[model samples]
Target: MTEKEKMLSGEYYDPGDAELVALRLKARLLTETLNQTSVSDADKRVNIVKSLFGSTGRSIHIESSFNCDYGVNIHVGENFYANFGCVILDVAEVRIGDNCLIAPQVGIYTATHPLDPIKRNSGVEYGKPVTIGHNCWIGGHATINPGVTLGNNVVVASGAVVTKSFGDNVVIGGNPARVIKEIACSDC
Candidate 1:
């Protein structure tokens, strides 16, 4: 398989591959333009985000200073909103479901390196996908790590570093986040 294909499949692949480099460059350019756009130009920002992301819902909004690697690997459902300084390293698929809100400085990462120093130093890296379910709220400065799958109506507390998956209707917090409490999902 090609490097891009391997990367998407969560296999170790050379990130310096030409195709991957070009894709990253493209994403960089697009995000730069997106960040520089005047807040008054909402239409233009929306258009740029449409062009940059692989797929997006009808009502998606992202604040300034947003960055991502391989924008095509990121997908968002309806009424998605990301606050300022949101960075997503989408080496693999990063999927966020409907009515998701991401606060400022929130980071969703899908990139990982081998534990073996030799292998890690070889410039071969892999990634695991991240899936956030519907109506999730990621608090400011929270980090969702690789391979984490959060179920619906989950609320992440500020500055939490989530390393593992959690099911629906829970509040998670702290480094290597743990479930703080189960939420009251009234609509569920």
Candidate 2:
């Protein structure tokens, strides 16, 4: 299987493969466009973002200093907002659904290295996709790890490290992010 196919299958693959190189080049160029000072038009900014990333809906806002490893692997739905210092290491696919608000310094990472020293030294690694459902609010400094799928209408408190999947209509917090409580629709 190809390296990308292996990655999508949740298998370990070499990170230095040609596919990764292409993705890196694209990301670098896209980042440069995003960082340009002369681009004052909002349409141009949106178009640049659309060209860089795999897909993005209308009315999306990404603050400056945003960084990603593979922009094409990241997809954002409608009315999404990512604050400053947001970093997505999307070695694998990362999908964020509609009306999601990602706070500053939030990180969504899909890359993971082997725990064994020997394997780690070989530069072989694996990645898993991350999915955030609709209307979710991810707070500042939060870290969403690989293969985690958060359900719709979930609220992740600040500084949380989400390592697992969460069901819909819940409030989660703390390291490794446990569910604190269920949120009622009336609270909205």
Off by over 4 Å in 1: none
The digit string of per-residue lDDT tens for model 2 on 1-188 reads 98878876779987789987887888988877886734457677787788889999988888777889978889999998989889999888999999999999999999998999999999888998999999999999999998899999999999999999998999999997999999988755
**In terms of TM-score, how similar is model 2 to the real structure?**
0.94
Stretches of model 2 off by over 4 angstroms after superposition: 37-39, 186-188
Over the stretch 6-77, how does candidate 1's per-residue lDDT look in tens digits?
Answer: 999999999999999999999999999999999999989999999999999999899999999989999999
lDDT of 2 at 174: 99
Which structure among the candidates has the greatest TM-score? 1
The TM-scores, one per candidate, come to 0.99, 0.94
- TM-score for candidate 1: 0.99
- Whose lDDT is greatest here? 1
